[model samples]
Target: MRIPFALAALTLLLGACTVSTGAEPEPTQVAGAVCDVPDDLRPARPYRIPQDEVAADVAVAFNMLAVSWSPQACRSGKDYPDARYQCAANQFGLTLHGLWPNGADNKHPRYCAAPGPAIAVETVRRHFCMIPSPSLQQHEWAAHGTCGWDSPEAYFAQAAKMWDGLNKPDLEAIPTQRLTAGAIRDAFVAANPGFPRDGVFIATTDGWFREARLCYSRDYRPMRCPRGLGAPDRERLKLAPKGVQQDAQRGVQTTG
Candidate 1:
């Protein structure tokens, strides 16, 4: 028997609306990364316990891969002693900020153990390309690393693995007028085919793009980001352009 005309139309509409459930995108190496680390690079300062910081060994609900836009960090002149190294030649872009284990409702675990020994100077030098700051690397190990991994080496290895896996977009290519939080997220998803759109979060300061936080499950698969994490989609974003120095005295914004 022939199907009813209305039913046939409905079936066609449903077929057209069906969503594809394809395999997830494989992670690729980031392009245009400029490490250019110096041979003599050393920790700007010795590691010390973060004053007024306390340990919160709460249950980890998920993981976040925080990546920084190096130009923005350098332009702000905030990371100070760390800036001496990271901003020296300004060759970094989309550097690994840290891999943090976040708990539910923002009660993330940190500084899980007392300061043992400073991370070996050689170890700090090895990962300088990825982190750029020796003191920050040591701090990350003592604070976030202690809560998850047993040794600094293991923690950094895991972080490096994840950092190398991401296919980061080249921010300098995008026109400044079209650069927005949503545009950055779109670029990320486009670069990583099976990556979820909501998995990327943008962090900004004074309307400048600072960081991109990618949400991940315990197994390290990309997942939807929690609400209220970073800047909204429509917010206009500015980039501090690699090699172009910002006039902090005048608070002028520069584009690549």
Candidate 2:
């Protein structure tokens, strides 16, 4: 699930480039104008990216990330020369389930029947942002099941583009979530050659980890959450809350 972004966007993330969110933008004054406008502000417009559009863009992203099947793998080249092609089966997996707000319980397995490491780009995205989760939303609509599209997150996110569009907005608009440093590492580890934990993935659409902020053991105990926000770290001042992350066990169920 190593989905590559546009080269320029990739560079921006890798370089950890700072866009002007923190500091005040310089002011611009027009002739005979007493009021000054900030140069950094984008045009203000209320946007509710339609579900169809969100699914479509998401689909484009998924296709960009999906593995290509060669003629051999497609099985149409059985009559052709001995040629190796991409493996269509087990290429990648994803699932956008109903938001498991209550949290995953003890019965939650370390490995999900879905979202294999092969295609976990969306998984990584989940760890970072919570809202505008088209995949999760679509999964909740679960009256229909699409094959080769069982991975709920993959299909829903893409389908969202068709049903609606995904937009980037702040605070009152886009649902954003933050990751504990641990959660970020956990995702990287999940994609590692042989991650020991199965179903060990933590799913949260909003908020940062309480235990993580409190310095819990690397062992990620969803059941052992410390109460309330504790001592502040350097970045604590910069933290935003989509709402606090509940105990790990809370993810066991999703609210329909």
Candidate 3:
């Protein structure tokens, strides 16, 4: 989910059977399998960030967590159906963007060290989508992953822990209408107690939901989002109709 801009926008679904009870229903499966696929490296309990000596910003994000995904990926036409970048948006509603390190500032440290073996493509697909592409994966490792752990597996394993903790929102729960950024944040707050209103950051291109970020303290606890980070809480946003995000550029309106 790391990008070059102030914040990067990153790009979900469900089980063996598919279901959509509303106009903007979220997916519950992926590739005809249960969306909640398990990974081999998942820890028996939540991985806690160590309270050892570290920089102040790194310490600030110890225990916090957030969820992010691209509604664009679910829409068709933007990416070829068979392209390596295509997403199973219709199957597993919201794709898992990477679990990132939250910082007190807009920018954070990256490429802290040399990366180890590249995470196998198969391993990545087992848990989430592949829109980052292989090259982006390497970049994410150097920029964000390396700041925390040594190997790609260890960094991603910890990321998996954060991804598993949050509950995906039911986009269908909202009426088929434009939503304010504040409204979207409220929905997440309703589902996730202890996740502060300020902790949730919405990244969008105009109105489309690009990524939903959450800030945390070094101990893995939720904290308020940094000032001037994320989309405005009151900004009105739109949900691209299914398969239409390919041409959604015209509709994109915000910097995020």
Clash count list over all predictions: 0, 41, 35
Off by over 4 Å in 3: 1-66, 73-85, 88-90, 129-136, 244-256
lDDT of 3 by residue, 1-256 (tens): 5455533322131222222334543333432223322222121111222233223344323323434344454453221121123233223345444556655555454445555565665544443432222333444554567677777677666766666566667654666564777777887888788778888878776567656777676756777766644778768877654333343322121111
Error of 3 at 252 (Å): 20
Model 2 lDDT on a 0 to 1 scale? 0.24
lDDT at residue 15 of model 3 (Cα atoms): 27
Instruction: Tell me the tens digit of each residue's lDDT in model 2 across 1-256.
Output: 6556787555543331022234552222111111112223221111222333122111110111111111221232211111110111111112112222111222211112223222243432332112122222333323121222466465445433322211111212222234343333244234432322222233222233211111122222222222222222212211223221221221122222
Best by lDDT: 1
Model 1 spans with C-alpha error above 4 angstroms = 1-33, 44-46, 50-52, 79-81, 244-256
166, model 2: CA deviation in Å? 3.0
Candidate 3 to native Cα RMSD, angstroms = 12.7
Please rank every candidate by TM-score, starting with the best: 1, 3, 2
Show the lowest summed lDDT stretch of 10 residues, model 3: 39-48
Provide the overall lDDT of each model, using Cα atoms, as 2-decimal numbers.
0.71, 0.24, 0.50
Give the Cα-based TM-score of candidate 2 against the true structure.
0.20
> Candidate 1 vs candidate 3: which has greater lDDT?
1
- Winner on lDDT between 2 and 3 is 3
lDDT score of residue 120 within candidate 3: 65
Name the best candidate (by TM-score). Answer: 1
